[model samples]
Target: MNVSDIKWEYIFNIELAIENFGYVLSGIGYTLLISAVGFALGLIWGFILSLMRISQLTLLNKFAAIYISFMRGTPTLVLLFLLYFGFPFIGVYFDAVPAAILGFTLSSAAYIAEIIRSALNAINHGQWEAGMSLGLPRQKVLWRIIVPQALRIAVPPLSNVILDLVKSSSLAAMITVPDIFQNAKIVGGRENDYMTMYIMVALIYWGICSGYEVLQRKLEKQFGSY
Candidate 1:
């Protein structure tokens, strides 16, 4: 077909895309909710795993290592399906949002654990000795002095993980969660403008990631001073 004969209108109807903008935007709330909750829960769980991985106990260290390895080895989508679809076999049930949150949290925790563990390892041994010399108990020193410094060191990497979680939130669409991607699909189907709607969705994700990048830089600067 000649270029002029191509049905460009079907591929990208800008007016239809514009009309459905609200539908796509509406999913942002669910996207943000999933990422925020997932990141927070992941951080908490990851910190616990980090502590276990670094502990003196052999069993704790081994368990943490295995758990982290398994989680990191699994693809995120596979994990999402396992939780959302596979759970029913074990008689556990989860709504789409909860299942997505659980999957993201589990997947993110593995990476976060490694990030925290590496940060902890980067601290000079003298810091721990100094804290001890100051008459602080081991637990006190860990919680107060060591962990604070490690977390400061971890800020940059953890920010990246948070951004990843935000992007991964889009995968919730597979489980029927009405996240941004799902909303875009719905709008595209209704408008028959898949290309336009998907491009708009991409821009929305890009905008969110770009905003986080700015915050990450500021955080790095603030933490670098410490």
Candidate 2:
């Protein structure tokens, strides 16, 4: 069908959408929870993965490389299904929310690891030499001298990962997590106004991502001075 042939006016119910907006907005809590917890945990795990990637131990380095490769290669939806559904086969189970958080964490960590790894490598070898000249141990040089500088470079990409996690949290609906997109689906089904409901949900997501962009800027400013 051609775009001009479509009935745009009949496809959206602005009044119905506005009245049910609150129900959709109510799901933002779950959305933020999944995104924030997932990101926080992923950051910790990803930093470790980054360290492992850079380690001299071949076992740790190869393992980290394979992990990052696997996570980055697979679709997160498959991961969510494995966590929420497949785990029950082995007598391990997670309700939708925990499953979603786990999925996002596992998925985001690979990207975060790469971001951190590149940032670490990007730092000049001069910093390492300088730290050694000061009689600091290698670990101390990494943590005290290199990491702080690497963090500034890592901030932008890390912020992007958080924003992506937030947006991707919508997929939690597939596992019945009742996030914002899920709630929108509920309202849409109830009101039979799918287009309107989805449009509003998209706008809400845009608003959220915009807020994260602002936060990213603030983080950049803070880190830029460090």
| C-alpha lDDT of all candidate models, in order | 0.91, 0.93
Q: Can you give the lDDT of residue 131 in candidate 2?
A: 99
Q: Write the per-residue lDDT of candidate 1 for residues 17-121, one digit (tens) a residue.
A: 788888898999999999989999999999999999999999999999999999999999999899889999999999999999999999999999999999999
Writing each residue's lDDT as its tens digit, candidate 2 over 150-176 gives 999999989989988988999999999
By lDDT, who's the top model here?
A: 2
Poorly placed runs, candidate 2 (over 4 Å): 1-6
Off by over 4 Å in 1: 1-12
Per-prediction TM-score: 0.93, 0.96
